[model samples]
Target: MTLRPISEDDIQALVDERLDTARRSEVEAYLAANPDARTRVDRLRTLGRDLRTAFAPIATEPVPAQLNLAHIVEARRRPRLQVSAWQAAAAAILLALGGLGGWGLHGTLAPAGVDALAQEASANFAVYAPDRTRPVELAASDSAELARWFSARLDRKVGVPDLRSADCRLMGGRLVATPHGPAGLLMYDDHRGTRFVVLMRPMAEPGDAPMREHRFGSATGYAWAQDGLGYSLVGAADPAVLHPLANTIRRTTATNT
Candidate 1:
């Protein structure tokens, strides 16, 4: 019996596992006629396997003690007192003095470069976090399209990290203006209903390490570079969750290169 030709949608659905049992069978039958389709599937499967092997080790690590749930709950319940203008000015003065003192200490103090980057990242997150409409230029449901679109906008190749294993789903992306011109924002959500991570990178700057972590406010973020592109992971998830995701991103991205 002659098999029906496989449609692009069929191949895509198979890639995404959205095909039903009968449709899956049909796709397999079609592949028997077209070995090229099988080759593509095999390549994708191998890529996924490599990513899993390289990064899954991080998932086994113990959660950090600093991520105590009780502390987070207590912190949420604490009163958020508003400071008066005079009080704000006084606090600013104190901060300036502290900064100057730290600067005087020089080598004794860690450089504020990372801290500045964290503040910048936090500020960027704050601006978009409350945005309910058009938070992302591309939706997570269209991650492949997003990857292509962002790659063009940033003038570098970009890829979305698969988070299903980590129990998260993509939440779309937005383009935001930054000190370095335009940037991309890709958000994700885990089972907790909490928005987990925001991956951001300069639309222009290129060349950096595979990963860097920054602590901003009460949150920690991981950023990285791979294949001549930059990436940043910002979220409230525990380091245990975020770190593995970062490793996966690094591995997947490196493989693609």
Candidate 2:
């Protein structure tokens, strides 16, 4: 008998790395045959990485004094809070499953939250990249002014990396908002009108990992945290085309810092 065809849930499980080895292999085979499904799975994985980057620090933070065991117990005695072990276990399971048991929970879980940078970046690119009339708030000719604007808003020095060698020139930038605060997006485009965005904002905590990479649907991204700032570069270009630009930006930024 034929195995049940892969469902969206299976793709999500694969993206979440929740599938067992055998199941994962099956999903991989399905993805290999279906490029569109593979892209969606990649996007989900990228969103998960961004969420973890934003929220992982909370897991390591010290409990507040008001939330200590003694204080909690005294509060419970005064105004009894009831939660069964089963309820707690179920809550834990939900968190483990990324706050839902199914893919239907995707759009419901995020709406400009701090953990949604990748999702927003991907969405923003999908929205603005193709627009010919008005893609950026500022124009490239005022490169200095644009950098100054972003630097002032971000409260950190930010710059547009020159990628002329890569045939992509600065197309200006815009200030975007995340749950934490305002973020910066420096846009660029090649002669062919292929667009890319470099998004940057402050990190929620210190000591995050130095660097990582992700793919959001048809786009590729490189995410890194350095000197209390987090940066992500997203584009629809293949990884080979994107990697050099990302590296050049990282090196240029490091030198300036």
TM-score of candidate 2 versus the correct structure, residues matched by position: 0.55
Q: Looking at model 1, report the run of 10 residues with the lowest lDDT sum.
A: 101-110
Candidate RMSDs in order: 34.2, 29.1
Scored by CA lDDT, what does every candidate get? 0.65, 0.74
- Model 1 earns a TM-score of 0.49
The numbered model that scores best in TM-score is: 2
Looking at model 1, the pairs that clash are 136-173, 136-174, 137-173, 137-174
Best by lDDT: 2
lDDT of 1 by residue, 100-203 (tens): 21122232432333233334455556555556885566788788887777778777676776767767788887665444445567777778766655545542
Tens digit per residue, CA lDDT, model 2, 1-257? 57668888898888777899888888899999999988888888889999999999998999899879998788777644345665687666446434321222353644332234555566557666777888899988988888899899989887767778778898988887654578887889889888998877877765444555677768887777667767777899988888888888778777765
Model 1: residue 10 alpha-carbon error in angstroms: 99
How many clashes in candidate 2? Answer: 0
